[model samples]
Target: MMPMVLDWFIGNETCETIKTKSSDDVCQGDSTCYNVDNGSGYRCKCLDGYQGDPYLPNGCQDIDECKDPNLNKCEKICENTKGNYTCLCPKGYHGDGRTDGTGCVANQSGGSLIIELTVGLGIGITVLIAGSTWSYWAFKKWKLIKLKHKFFRQNGGLMLQQELSRRDSSTETAKIFSSEELETATNNYDESRIIGRGGYGTVYKGTLSDGRTVAIKKSQVVDESQIDQFINEVVVLSQINHRNVVKLLGCCLETEVPLLVYEFITNGTLFEHIHNKNKASSLTFETRLRIAAETAGVLSYLHSSASIPIIHRDVKSTNILLDDSYTAKVSDFGASRLVPLDQAGISTVVQGTLGYLDPEYLQTSQLTEKSDVYSFGVVLLELLTGQKALCFERLEEDRNLAMYFISALKEDRLVQILEKCVVDGAKIEMVEEIGSLARRCLRVKGEERPTMKEVAMELEGLRMMLEHHPWVNNDESRLEETEYLLGEASLKIGSNGGMNNVTYDSITDHIILQVGHGR
Candidate 1:
């Protein structure tokens, strides 16, 4: 394509046959001949220190390597010959003149310290390079340390330390983790480590240095205005030992954003199991009821059992995690508030997932234990109906599942609107019982809604009834007790396990039974 022809022997023959002629076709002085690999003929070349056409006699000329400094590796003098050149050392120097051979060194009677000089130079260079690298990295390390200190101070770390010291060691439950520890565990919060993310924060699956797999929640910016409450989260969770509650291993305040470490739950959220087509179909009504009971038990303990009453401001199916066994673990207390016992509930800036938030709380911003109940009610509806808390695919008026469900109950579409799987897997009576309980929880007024404690008790009673015989001896009153509470003198095991003495009193709140865990 370049319009060029390849040079070859005119006859396209090997050099041996051509050299037999003993003609001028042979290679010139300082040149070598060889047959082309393609058998296109022979070609010639000049040797070292020579360059020229090999077709003519004496055509290859000796290169003046002495005139070309780069061509000669000489320390002092260079002598050009027919094909190459020789190098010589200077008068006061010894050793070969060529640097590759034995570069010139001073010829002294006393041995020269050339080796020592070489070693000294090598060490000096190594130290200089090492020092520069160390300085650069050291500066980076210093900046990180300074930044961590700044963040720790900004997040009230010192105040936390003081508060922790003020209390007895027996109450110490939340550990303070370093930023590096979490970074290593989460591979520096790499994208691959991320398990879930939402408006509040992102949760990453991490493995601690101690080899425990954990869930690391990296939250959004903290409200410096509520630093005290932020720190109190440790106190609130530390005192909670419920198996149904996700355990807070520790927290990290060394970052611009805070990080909370919790025990990792293997199975995903109840939301996924209920809404995901494949998972929801496999879940039986029994499993769903137990999960509901476990979650309610956690909220109940937080409200009525903890030293300080806590209101889970954010409660939904997604916040309810399931373990390998599908047992519920109430998690994500990012929006929870600790209420003083004297106050029934705390007034807060309304914050919660849509479709599940309490309308009362949304209106008045008065978050109470009932607010969580309302949200839990929505989760219960999800279990029964297998629908999202909010979905736009339905009629505009029915987009909110709570409203849709309430309307269905009013029109007596309970049997028709229930998830096919739930209806098929559970007894009709049990299904209706849960449906009625969920309706109670979704009541418009917070006070009218059952407390999380009442919900947990009722759910546990329902579960016990399913697993065993009813407390009454086939009495017609069994249906009556199902509407309010289990029959009188009925000993019921809590969802997580302790036995509670349940009785039908005028008010359910007066029952001071132990709603704790133990089979």
Candidate 2:
């Protein structure tokens, strides 16, 4: 009030004197208030190391002089304080301005006590934080690698190796693939590379760095009950050295679910080609017969030639793969059983594909090599008729093709159900021979079926006979006109309508040179 009265005598018409006095009263810390002298009221100024007018609210700020490149004393490190800056030592270097002494004065050995204390404290804190973080990350990485190794050993890696060694080392073509290699090949087991899925595992197509294509089958989670079965499957399949069998290249046990690597089959499964309309019509009788013969040869090889005879408990058309040349390559030994040669048979629970499964084996809980023979026979029926083993779309009595086929044979009505593709006027004898052979194979008693060796021999004979005389068994003359257009040589049919061999290789040279279309 006294200041205001004094300013009123000095012409305080706009109250500028009172306002300046009020602003000056609030100024603090290296600041002062002054009137603009032009009657614009009052403002405040801060001293060095501060910013803004102190008279206004939140106007003052500490100066960031360290941001200036010229203020940096260290090579790469710089720090700012209230009115001063720091000459901090750079990373991997020590001493406080004693070595270079560029901007800061040198501190002597013992006389540098204060400078050393501050520098040491800062360096020590930084190093401790960095080292703790690095250690934590390194520990985590090491633990992950260790866990993978533990699982590799636990999942019967050593046991599988021992099983593989028991066989003829020279004949086995498969190589042991490492977990890291497979992971890299499949892009760390990426979901996009998956080609097929099954109840037990997912199958992925992988290409190695060396350009080798492979199928990697990764098993689903293994429960306690399935562990032994899984291990047993690995053991049995690893030792099988037959050419017809699907080659088990190796396995990766590092993952939570084990992965099995197999040789890649390019043309896909026989089942796909048979059921698919386009593929079914493309197959010729010769291709189908060859597929049957090769498949039977594989079954026979497993049942008789293996060290411990194997019964492929589940033999279905889907499990049979075809090569680029349409050559049949039997695969999928996951459900195979190793039977001791000395034993007549083994007693096991029923397990197999439903339609192809042997009724005798399923009912008795007694499995034998003939169980696979029955399944093979059912697959043979599929090849003959180009129909599914079980199709509910048909009448109830004709739904199960195997049952329908057997009934047809009993009623002498096989010609009614034969696929148009197979109706190449096959001689009645040859047709009866094949039908009778299939019926014998599907006999209710396992002992009644022919051995795989017999089946293979018979099919091979049929192939040889047909190749020598192409026209003998063909029922359809439309196929004859097609063959004539293709310039295939004609065979002579006797009065009995049976085929006699004639030379056709000269004309067939071109056709044989062509790529095989059926798989």
TM-score of each predicted structure versus truth: 0.67, 0.63
Candidate 2: 10-residue stretch with minimal lDDT = 510-519
Candidate 1: tens digits of C-alpha lDDT, residues 318-391: 89898888989999988888898799887788899999999999999888889999999999999899889999
Give the per-residue lDDT digits (tens) of candidate 2, residues 197-299.
Answer: 7655688999987998988988676554555556666666766765666788777777777778888999888998999988887677778877887788788
The global Cα lDDT (0 to 1) of model 1 is 0.80
**What lDDT does the true structure give each of the candidates?**
0.80, 0.71
Q: What lDDT does candidate 2 reach at residue 477?
A: 56
What is the Cα root-mean-square deviation between model 1 and the actual structure? 18.5
User: CA shift at 276, candidate 2, in angstroms?
Assistant: 0.9
Give the count of colliding residue pairs in each prediction.
Answer: 3, 7
Error of 1 at 169 (Å): 3.0
